[model samples]
Target chain A: MNQQFKDYSQVVSQYIGNLPNDGGDWLVAQRSSAAERFTELGFPHAKLEAWKYTGIEGLLKQGFETLDKSPEFAEHAVLNQFLPEPVAGRLVFVDGVYQADLSTCDAVGITVGNLRSAMAASDRTVLEAIGSLSGVGDHGFAALNLATVHDGAVIRVAAKTSLEQPVELLHMATKSAEGQALRSRHLVMLETGASANLIERYVALDGVAYFNNLVCEISLAQGARLTHQRVQHESPKAYHLSDIHLGLQADARYHGINAAVGAAWSRTVIHNRFLDRGASCELDGIYLAGDGQLTDFHLDVDHAVPHCDSRESFKGILHGAGKAVFDGLIQVREQAQKSQAHLHNANLMLSRQAEIDTKPQLVILADDVQCSHGTTVGQLDPQAVFYLRSRGIDEQLARHLLCLGFASEVIDRFESETLRLQLTEVIRQQVRG
Target chain B: MLTIKNLTANVDSKEILRGVDLDVKAGEVHAIMGPNGSGKSTLAHILSGRDGYEVTGGEILYKGQDLLRLETEERAQQGIFLAMQYPVELPGVNNMTFLRESMNAIRRSRHEAEIDAVSFMKLVREKAASVKFDQKLLKRSVNAGFSGGEKKRNEILQMAMLEPYLAILDETDSGLDIDALRTVADGVNLLRSPERSMIVVTHYQRLLEYIEPDHVHVLAGGRIIRSGGKELALELEAKGYGWLLEEAAA
Candidate 1:
């Protein structure tokens, strides 16, 4: 069946009948227009310039549909390794539906809860963040998420507050969510003079075939700081797509890390814009793609104001028949003098069958701006391998060490010890395979 | 303890080492000094089991073992160390981690107890201090963005930790100033004993002034044409290699 033929009817119909009508008429009208946009845009294809290397034919052929109700899952015991311990706050979601019984919100200076409730009560933070930054205009995936998302995590920080511990959101899927489409919306708003750490991890059962589409919108007020960590470890047979939008005000700082390690096909698009001068965003990421996997990261940063700096460093380890694409673009506007933007993408192709495409572009329209981009897609340096082997390390272990070296620059940026250790083990296993 | 007889090697079908013969007894420092394009590094690399060189005709005997048959790590496990002319810069692997992993690997092959975190840290610190290397560099990526002198010091530090039976220093004095050369020479001299043998390959007589060599060999056109005592280095330095290259050609 053609993807256009199956259409977004099933998805729109399920959105109209989701849970309850507590989100008020505004949300209803917005969802209706987004549903129409979803129908018009449909699913992103290979012909699209943004998705030339990554084809969604296999995902669209899966024939996904929205779930009638939240699925029952009692496998919390086996998920301890995926969740870091002693976090300040933990919000658990299964198939995009908030599970309050399995969650705990104990952090100070924050009003954190389910997004559906925040939307129902017309929360001011949620109202400004949900669809404002990540609009449904050009991105079809974001539109689909805005039109069909049920329940997700919502975090609002009070001014002049800094949390001591990290806030975590664990999004997992079970067998019941297989063959279904799951959409989640995450909103994070930091008032002036506030700072917090956020971690959003996506996971599913082994070999589960599901579609996880998520949109995350983050807004930072003046002098606000945030550290965001996103880990996508979906099932080997699942399709995952995430759209992350970051808006920074004057003197606000943001640091983000994206670790993509699973899913048959996955893409994470991050959009960063400077709302005022003196803001800085440093984004770092690492990815591992093995046999029959396609992992991609696309980052777009706009330097519209002066005195803003944006830096992106991404690396990937691809083996077997895996394929990965990294596209990063940094644009400095004409009025944005003294803007500093630098992007780097490096990949280690560990196998003969692996493929990696890195495209880093910088467009500077202003004078006296520092802008540069560099990318490298290559196999492990044989000289470096020889250096390790000459030190008495075996060749296999040497290769694994070099591969791990490529990822350490990004992995070491995470503040969570548990998550860092977990990512280390994951990189080890991927190289060993 | 070390012997290379009629060692002939080729790289990319071009002969680099042509019928080179050398021998070093225990506790002896044999300096292989040669002009440019004389394949000084090839001999060191072949002995250390580096790949990419086709040893067309050569037989290396290390403690009476067929050295050419062993893999690179195997050769290293059996206590053969090569202080690379240009130490590789690994971008993200910590220097201390690399040292510890390498030490443990060699130890594991010898069926000895491995060094744990505490002991390894202590050992690396002492060794680094002895080599005049900064302890802070141990926490950084291995040799990444290091100065030339720092790289040479790192090589000596690795040599100190490994305690290899046969140490091949290939042009270890190429990029060091007088102070760094003296420090590195001191480190090399400290490692010298009745049981450890060393082959110091260099192109200058300055390093020979500090670490006195037992035997000096002048190699020209891929073959060693002159072999003499430490005085031979002074003679060659006084007079350029023009006469030696002519003699080798003749």
Candidate 2:
């Protein structure tokens, strides 16, 4: 192996060894295996098709300082700005480590605990699916996250339980020093016949250069329904890489919405696998990038079994000199016959300097499947702008209103009113700025 | 209240309006009757400052100011309103929100205190009822999923709310039934005042029976070929534009 690969493997091994092994033997073993695979494949380059748009050379060259714990920082007002009233549970993490004293989980039938506590409690069900949905070490960051998986939340919804209130997971990053690197791992599982809503927010507290590596896996059993939402609003000095892997069983329903607004350089990967028939999934995403921000989304929907349906739509607005990349793929395996899937991606470039790259792909092996993919990139309709302006709305307000209307198609899909409004404000700020 | 002097405009380098001149005083409704492709819509679009239309020559004056120099919204705030022939659908922006924003914008430019939400809702509901629009339409996106008639009624409802000094109804009667056209005309008539002027542009004379104009002009080949009192619209409907075209050529 090369010297760089050797150094990376050593760091992974050392991090794993330092983890407390109290009843977390299985998790440790999984991490070690994942680490071995990661060591074998250090970092992906331009050669890899999936990593073509996102280059990891900057992350590798800087050699981030490992951040096992968070430093003391003032409470961010934006943190509590849009928190839903009377949430069933709320967990706050700073730089991957949980701050239990500031957390609350008062709702019945829903338990929100730190991953460390759950691991030490030896929850076999949680351990079995820790890194299972993301699969074994296909991506370099997934492997690296599994290796240094120090702290995050373990959200459990009991069987036959239905949560009236949403559960919030806030992952915050505060720089103790420049070049700090934080890694977080979250495992959430919904038992049979359980239904719940989960909102995860990642915000940067400091504007110092840092790297945030996060991985979350979700598993839903038969008749389980989950609404998962992720919002990334990091500082302009931060680099974020997040992965979400979901698994659905028979009759399971999953809805996911991802909003990427912050971070100097960010990439989000969402991989969803439907394991059985009668599974339904709805995925929606919106990314509003302005100024010098670089936002990228790579999503994949795999239909492994027959008689499933999935719908995916993503919209992006690039302003100023910002750049955005979207690569969405819907794959229907041969055995997944009678599957129906549709994928659409649209982008609005406000300034000529703004750039967007979109690729929508569909690989259907089953002749009985119905699948379609489309992408559109253009500026705001001048006719629409003029129409609004003629109604006595100023040019700036007219443009803002037009852009809001453009993004509202996706924002209106949210069932939660509070989250929808919060997202609207975020979108407005991004567009106006 | 409004004056157009030898105005010429082009869209995409193709001339649509060729030296058109007309004038309308307060308390008078001037109807411009023209065949399709006769620069009828282009005139309305240019008056509203829609992009892609280059005003090659001439000028428009509103209340003695250079109207062509003002921005679309600025002209709108100065009491100019254009009821689009085809209203653009805005999905996700609620009717109430759009109206409030427009009302506030005009009010702000006029240095008037903004209306609160309660007052705004009351005004909107009242105007909505005056135009016979369903209250449920206010909850939906602006003109989204609305039928053709409903979209026109929505525009009239907006006119009632904004209460502009000069309202330009651009083919507002095109897709409406008899009842809908009556409601729209009634709404426009109710807002008519000595200080408010109107320009009703339509190709058909059937709408004239509902919203009677004081003066009617025949716009053929990008110019007003003839001008007369309200009876002129009826004469055009009876004789058709072919005779008017022959007269203009002569």
Candidate 3:
């Protein structure tokens, strides 16, 4: 018997039998099939080509026992530091269970609440959007998340509505359920001509050792614009796996910036598909790993229609025995004429033992497509260090400045000043350690 | 202001500077002319405390202190500057931020108060104008995507900002046109004073036309083959370096 798979299946089956089918039999069917899919796929191993550079053996061996019921927040003030000051329309989720008391939607025009409530109202939009992309049979972790998603976030913006303040979603893993796994599912849909700023953050309380599987599916209609920011800072003993699926229609624009600095081992996969003409997606990310940590970013941008454009830039800074991997793929179909895409991956390795594996793939099948990718891996430039030192900057400060500058190139693109400043400090702290 | 006695250096285990001797007084401008790979850059790098260059046998005295024993930043704090031939590009560090931090570091080392933002901006503007550096470029990354001329001008800007007591220009005019050369030369000349001395290391003589030197020395085969007054540069420019190589052999 595959012990790892059996452990997950047994826990999932027990949880499935306990779930209340209030949303009718459709939701129950979806949950059961998802569990079967995850069991068949099993945990990704090193043998999988896509997971070659990363191994989940240790994470699987941890034996993630499922929690019988959602754990309540332990009423700790520590959650304050993980959130932005003067919170604006923020949703707080602890152990994959949405906390309504801790969450508030300041904006009156936006519809932001928990998925469980929306399911009670028989919200077809919420139900259809939650597991819409999970039927494809890829992404075992995302399938697992769908199988056990008890409560997540549901955000819907009507046509021509604009939100002044960004909506922040905080997912925290508390120490109460140290050995359990938490699954989170989020659905974000914006109608035509709608605009909003969204922030999805993941954090784990100190010393929490759990598995967090999150799936966020987003759809932007024609002429819609969404700026999404994701910040992941899990505890050193926790495991995090996130999948983001974004679908953009004609004239829709999506800008995403992901900053990941915490977690013992984490991987974030972002898949953006442009389904209509004149759509554009811009994605930028920064990942820092120190000591024994491992961080990975896998971005795939697919252009199925013509006149679509995408730009991707992800940077990794590794110190000590840390390891990082960045794989960026831009695929343009044969019918995607006039499709333009650019991808760049740069890594800075501070320690000799640190390793970075970067792969930038650009496949253009159209005749008039413009696609290019560039990857660079190196330590700080000696010439630059000497230049700084020759001007009286100390050796240590000089190195810090260089690394900060490298990481800031991505953070500087953030549109929100509050997030930008906060993330700058976060990056500074990471670089300091 | 600076003295080099039987200074020898090697690069990557290969001896580059066999034995060189030089002396410069305050308020003096000495030019070192040499062929390619004759240790002009190696000498400058060694004085600036660059790594990987072994000082096989050398003694450099700067203001009566042993210069080689100090670290690169320590040497800079002591007022020794080397304007690199190829200025390094820091892609995300703002030029103004780099200049301000560098100036403050040196000032702090000298036990002086750090310059305030207003004063620093004012001072930078004044110095930038001297080099004809655009105010807009100050907001950009240090030397990133800058033209060769802009990079050379940036080096001169740093030199003017630091105000080194003994400045070493390592082929500063290599990639500049006549217009850029004049701008750089003017910036260097503006910094020349009675309390300061300069060593102009160049492969060509065009830079000397703009910033005339008090003394000129011809270096060939890692040794000073000849030394003369200011007119030496003109003669060397007229005759190729081969003539000096033959003269050194003879």
Q: Count the backbone clashes (under 3 Å) in each candidate.
A: 0, 0, 0
Report lDDT per candidate. 0.87, 0.85, 0.86
**Tens-place lDDT digits, model 3, residues A1-433:** 2876777787778878877765443467778888889887887777887799988877887877666566655666535644455534888888777788878876766888988788778888877776665452375777677787767898888899888778888888777758878777788999999998898877776778888877888999998999998888888888888888999999999999998888889999999989789999999999988887889999989999999999998998998898998989889999999999999999998888898988899888899988888999989988889999998999988988899889878988876676678777766666642
Question: Residue B206 of model 2: what lDDT?
Answer: 88
TM, every model:
0.94, 0.95, 0.92
The residue-by-residue lDDT of candidate 1 on A1-433, one tens digit each, is 3544356666575767663665453467667778888777877777888899988878778888877677777755435634645777888888778877777777789878988787768877576677888886466777777777777788888999998788888888888888988988888899999999998898775578999988888999999999998899898899999888999999999999889998899999999989999999999999988899999999989999999999999999999999998989888999999899989998888888999887888888999888888888888888999999999999988887888778898999988877788888888877652
After superposing the true interface residues, what Cα RMSD does each candidate give? Answer: 0.6, 1.2, 0.7
Sort the candidates on lDDT, descending order: 1, 3, 2
> Cα deviation in Å at residue B222, candidate 2?
3.2
The 10-residue segment with the lowest total lDDT in model 3 chain B: B239-248
lDDT of 2: 0.85
Model 1's CAPRI class is medium
Candidate 2: regions farther than 4 A off: A1-7, A17-26, A75-82, B11-18
- On the 0 to 100 scale, the lDDT of residue A297 in model 2 is 95
Q: Which ten residues in a row have the lowest lDDT in candidate 3 chain A?
A: A78-87
C-alpha RMSD by candidate, in order: 2.5, 2.3, 2.8
**Interface DockQ per candidate:** 0.73, 0.74, 0.75
Reference-based lDDT, residue A133, model 3: 56
Candidate 3 has a DockQ of: 0.75
